[model samples]
Target: MKKIGIFLCLIFLWSNINASAITYPKITSQGAVLMDINNGKILFQKNGHGRYAPASTTKVMTALLALEKCKLDDNVIVGKNPPLEDGSKIFLTKGEVLTVDQLLYALLLHSANDAALALAEHISGSKEEFAHLMNERANQLGCKDTNFLNPNGLYESKHYTSAYDLAQIASNAMKSSKFREIVSTLSFDIAPTNNHPEIRHLHNENKLLYSQKYKYPNADGIKTGYTIKAKHTYIGSATRNGKTLVVVLLSGVKGYYKDA
Candidate 1:
């Protein structure tokens, strides 16, 4: 009988050990982490601290800096390269005019590289200057592991951030009511202006919004980033029962779409 009792205790201890080890999934992929907003505790993590190409997720920081440095009502004069070109765009044309807010909408929602340029220009007077500002802002945020070489998460060898650092960025951005409003919006309709079209409908790239059935109940605003080098990266936030969670996934496969 004593032997059996000892065996039982050993089993219990082993089970507890296993439970602790199972806190979160193993980080086999590039980098990923889920954070609880209230306590800032890491609910899950995997290679989160390692640097990797963040793709367009970097735009979150760009948007943050633009929001802080410029007024939404301010107008941005469209420039070349980001408009009427080959790649992702907001249909922005050289010499066209758009409000800072409108350009922001196009930049964040549409992932329009051109929209990013116009907003960059509006904020720093030139793309080169804006890139400098982005780097400075990253440092100010204390994201020692993050670096931004471009406004859009477009491919630039110098642009990379760890999942841990991206979470850091999202944490600060969530504090902004404006950021929340812009990212949570499933769709945005901007009336046509003299310089542009009559109507602009903006849709978020987050697949969670598109499918409308993410396992995460409180899934809210945020952006998605992708490139050949950066696979599919997502910075997503969700809320439930007043508690919020932010997740960052970098260089992962499509299987992670369900929101574990």
Candidate 2:
């Protein structure tokens, strides 16, 4: 009887432990993925490999290419007026000049379409040529499901990526100290340029970085996006107890922070 009681107690403890273990939460995003960057392990996923519009998250690859191709201090001249687009912007005028580093800050913090276009043109001579570099680098990074139609991620039929592919791209991007620094920035102030007299104050669009109610501790980085077709997209990374985790959410519901 004593031995049988001990065995029963052991079974109960085992059951309780299993019940208390961490479990994946149900997310409203059409596609999502959580990855452990330290060891390349996928923690959780929902339609992670399905192709979907990535929105402005495309800038991750754009920024990566800019970093690789241009020195941080290299001057990028906006020789021609940036293409007219109907989303977030820095309002750059023709002939405006800013360093590659400064433009990267604007690009990542504000999701500036103009900055994206300027960088693309400066680095590769035209948007078409820059997109080729983005694709080449993405392919090298093992992103089999990603294709870039433009630098700013303005919606295009051919512009699509999978959550799994983006996770890979983001994982590689985070390896750069400069990329991490730009994404982690909460707010930045850009001094007036020759073309614009007023100083530009840029704020990060990712609410997970600042919202007191939805704040995730140690949450840094990534990007956010929304279009009529791409409901709401977010890629986020946070470090806790020495481990860094990356999450990708595509076509998510309104409560983005919780879903992220």
Candidate 3:
């Protein structure tokens, strides 16, 4: 009888220990998601489908569209009517000529609003037309809550996506070799052009790629966003031991890097 009682107590202790080990991390983000990239299975979620302003992470879709529509070496001439974008720009002047390849690096690395506009105009002729393409592509990707109003993720009430939707977008974008390459590149330098004499040096904004405290050695190829309305948003991907995992956070507080 004493041996049987001891065995039952041991079993109870082991079960509790396992439960504690598997508990989810505490997150302060209003919306968060973790996904297994190989099978497209969601591992964890917190308001993953809740709609909020996506800010510049919207460029993931923009970059995808441009890559599909334009060739790498194709020259995109900046038009006279550049959209007046508010935040983060590569300062492209009217009539500046740059290859689609250079624009892509600027778009993804610097989150350059002007570069996004240039790529959008080069592909679809106007922001309105480019947004149409963005929506069509989002629908094809199985995203139901995403609506892109502009190429750069400027704050617009109509431009919103959920954590789940952004994660799916990142996963899809990562499949493209070019997209993957650009995101993983820590920095790139664009030489002086006829219109702009100074070199355009761009650095990636994803802290998880560079910050010592937040760095994830396996992390590569993703985007980040922030705005007055959107707060701090991020899409992060990491691979370990042949497994790839993607994490998305929206409206996160200061500890987003650790929480992610």
Comparison by lDDT, 2 against 3, better one? 3
Error of 3 at 88 (Å): 0.5
- Tens digits of per-residue lDDT for model 2 on 1-260? 11111112223332344423445567788888877677777767889899999999999988988888899999888857464655888888888888899899989999998999999999889889989989989899888888898898889999999999999989988989999988999999988888889989999887768877666656788999888898888899877666677888998867866777
TM-score to true structure, per model: 0.85, 0.90, 0.90
After superposition, which runs of candidate 2 have C-alpha atoms over 4 Å from their true positions? 1-21, 81-83
Count the clashes in each prediction: 7, 0, 1
Query: Please, what are the lDDT tens digits per residue for candidate 1 over residues 61-168?
Result: 888887888888987777675674335776777888778788777767888788887788777887788888988877776677887777888887878898888888
- lDDT for 233 in candidate 2 is 87
Q: Quantify how close model 2 is to the true structure by its C-alpha RMSD in Å.
A: 8.0
Candidate 1 TM-score, true structure as reference: 0.85
The Cα error of candidate 3 at residue 49, in Å, is 0.8
Clashing pairs in 3: 55-153
Per-candidate Cα lDDT values, in order, are 0.73, 0.82, 0.82
